[model samples]
Target: MTDYEKFKIRHNVITLGKKEYDIAIDKFVRKALKNKDVVSIYKIGSIRYPGLSDIDLIVFLKDRPKHFSIKKFSIKNLSAKEKYMFMHEIFAVPDSMGGKIKLLYPIFSLEHLGGKKYDFIEPETSDFIPFFIQEYVKGYMSWPDRIIRKGIIDEREIIPQVYATKYSIGIYQKILGYSSKEFERKCRQYIKVAENLREDFYKTKKDERDKIIIDLIYLTKEINNAMFFDLKKYLDKNIKTKPRTITLYLGFRPNIVVFNKHIDYMEFLNIRFLPSNFSLICKKDLSGAFNDEKLEKAFEKRYKLIEQYDDFIYKNNLGRFMMLTNMKSQFNITSFIKKRVSKN
Candidate 1:
């Protein structure tokens, strides 16, 4: 099919109403089932939540389809870079980590074999910290960057961001082994917050919408900061670093704030594998920095749960090497030349 025609089909599919969307899903399922290589086809994501925004599917295939094609591959055999590339190509996430999710239509599908429903293995116990930090600290907190950093609030953007944050929090809670009941309790608050803010955004006057947006944004930021501070404390105790330190950042291209000292050095070792917006500071400097009793208790509780697992892979060095090798294979000079020659 022509690219433009494909685009038109996708546009129409995405705009489908509840009834039309269900029909499209049934049709897709039927076609997917017809393929002999196909095993199980699971419908996932917001659709399960009665969200009609887009459809997400995990399609399991018996073997790789064709040669060097992006279309089909066993999830078990995918390199880290290939997996990353696959997700980036399929999902409509923004470059900024915590931005709203908008899947490209007519469907965003992942082809896999010997994979769980999510097209990936469950995260290891050691994966908790980095996973939590990435989802909560970076993804949830960074959602309001446009409004918080600058005074620019897009009316169209608020509800989606809130929904993204709510979903991110819930997903992490479930993945990290929070009890179903606890997950409901913890996530419901954010759900309510998102729903209320969404309601206020649509119902409020133009002059008043910004205030509501800013208020909700700040409230989320405050909660995120508390979690971050608690997380930092956890890292300081559990993760061993040579020079005991914690680095706080102030801006997007964040300036370092260690204790009360503002260090203006851009080139420095980031102690933890934290996001770039943080810096390293002496542990002594942050002796009394965090004092949130509730957050600290909650953080410790989760950490103890992770500790119950015996076989823990903390630093994923092998995974990193595999990712680098995959990247080189795909993007090296030889591969680039091959692609250009083929195009010619």
Candidate 2:
């Protein structure tokens, strides 16, 4: 059998019937390719369970087009809401020639559909991006807790979202690298627990349902802990400076030492979020740093510390921090300055 045939067979086994969906998917791909700017389209995410998961397609473009739309292409399998959501997702991606290709997970299966074959340049996997993803996914983890807090009795509405979050955690765990067999095993085990819990949710009563949700939350925590253990260890060892929090934004330096919380640092630095570059956070209605001179001095000092961080990362062979800052900047650097940085 050909490689593509083998690949399709494997997907059929995973989806338990890809043949049914293939016709619609083929049509969708052909329709999507109507746009000249559409370079390639990729079907992402694991559609392991049928109804719970929706089709995720990543449409890559050569350049920013004047207009883009996916409303006309209809998938009978997908609800009107799902199609609308997919349209929004396609529109959300800022498609520039060399913009960072952010995936739902780093280790997603990118099945090519139609259009010219183009190489998708994913950013180098670093502590910076993964850490942010990890933090962001934590919001999903809190759904069960939120439901419980709000005295939500009918779990039928909330179960799907929880399942989706569990699936996402499993996928994102793949980016940590498959070096650790034990970590992978834990992920699978936790995901299986989540799956079982989801199935049982419909059959059980309110009390039993609550128990299931709690179990799901526990399993979710276990998976997250196992997944991020190595990252936590690395951060514990490396990250210097006690920033207010380990929270990361796109622009405004890799490490920002907050002198005062109130000051608009972006305005102070005169940084804007460029299409090609990471944008600075908003400048208005912030508090903290009152003295402009002190804030400027703090920023300069922070830049020097960042230089030291770069040297340490390169020495350790951990890759550069998201292609930011001048690696060759002659700002007088030092070897790994150790400070008590907050852990994520």
lDDT of each: 0.38, 0.41
Model 2 agreement with the true structure over 152-175: per-residue lDDT tens digits: 433333445556655565445544
Clashing pairs in 1: 244-283, 245-281, 247-279
Best candidate, TM-score: 2
lDDT tens readout by residue for model 1, 133-222? 423453356555445656555444454666666655554454443335754565577678667765444355644545555566665665
Q: Candidate 2: which stretches are off by over 4 Å? A: 1-20, 70-107, 121-139, 151-188, 195-214, 221-236, 242-344
- Listed in order, each prediction's TM-score against the native is 0.44, 0.48
- Relative to the true structure, candidate 1 has a C-alpha RMSD (angstroms) of 14.0
Which regions of candidate 1 fall more than 4 Å away from where they truly are? 1-16, 27-39, 46-52, 61-127, 150-157, 167-190, 197-211, 243-344
Please state every model's RMSD to the true fold in angstroms.
14.0, 15.4
